[model samples]
Target: MWFTAGLLMAGAVVGNAVLIGQMSGREPVLVLARDVAWGQPVSGDDVKTVDLPVEVGAFAVREVAQAGIVGQVAGRNLHAGDLLAPDDLAAQAVPGPGQWVLGLRLEPGRYPARGLAPNDPIAVHPAPDEGVSSGSGTQQSGQEFPARVVHVSPPDADGAITADVLIPESTAPAAVEAAVGGAQVSLLGPPQK
Candidate 1:
């Protein structure tokens, strides 16, 4: 009697395991292969497939659903390894190869209280009247360089913000110069996207 009961319990455990496996909604999904910046194109090279439970997240795009991605643009900065979602793509910008994207740190006094928003046109200039000294210990000044804000970090404990800007390659050197020389970037308002 004891042997029969043990065998029945083992059989029930195995049967339950098989039933759970069948119900486990594991599925294949296409997630970001790498960090795709704001407005970048979504191509096959930017995605990869992996099996995940059915309830991944809202807007999750499946691997088989990638046919609609090739020409679509990233609506915002897509971090590496994030699950690709439908709303993440749109008929928005695809940053050209000639656009240079970079970051700059700015203090509360240096940038506007309203702050820069993504895709907002901006101009980089050495913070006016700063009289800052450079690496050579000589006073340095910089001029405005046209650019667009790609992303803006929320203020830290001290209220400083870091902004990522995209500018034409032809003017990247000047933008870097202005930033490194203590620049202040002006947010022109109204995001382009």
Candidate 2:
């Protein structure tokens, strides 16, 4: 009984020492202090730093990079407590020159059930009810224009989602015409390389 007790004590001490050694090499990284909407600027108060094991720290936004990240637009919907990653920010404003931002008020079933986030690739189709006629005098419902989502809001009391999309200059006129009646947005797969 005495030998068995000594063996258990030694094992506990060795296990604790190993755990402490693994946790000792930590570095500070940025984590969100609050929820940040897509396209919204990141402020100093929006993030806080915490020490994490070096392995995870290697891929996280370093505490030193906070200055550069501040005032930058969020590339996605960053939830509170989310670890800041380099890809989580956009370096420039959305809808660069020659692009127009269009607001799409979509009802449930009109958009993907899974929901949308910033920078999501999408294709906008003319609402069939809108009866937009093409140059050939045919309805434009079958045509889709490529667009990128700038921001998407949660469903409101009426279950309507408001998505702001970046439309190319050439397609902005047609998109606006379609949006005046309503539009159906389809989430596309990840952009190809």
Best by lDDT: 2
lDDT of 1 by residue, 43-154 (tens): 8899988888777733588878888788788887787789898888877563567877878888887877788776677878765445567777776666578887877888
- Please provide TM-scores, in order, for all candidate models, with all chains considered together: 0.49, 0.72
Worst 10 residues of 1 by lDDT: 125-134
User: Whole-model lDDT, candidate 1?
Assistant: 0.78
* 108-167: candidate 2 lDDT, tens digit per residue: 888888887877888888777544677777665645799888878789999999989888
Model 1 misplaced regions, further than 4 Å: 1-66, 75-95, 128-140, 189-193
Candidate 1 C-alpha error for residue 10, in Å:
59
Q: What shift in Å separates residue 123 of candidate 2 from its native position after superposition?
A: 1.2
- Cα lDDT listed for each candidate: 0.78, 0.85
Q: Give the TM-score of candidate 2.
A: 0.72
- TM-score: which candidate is best? 2
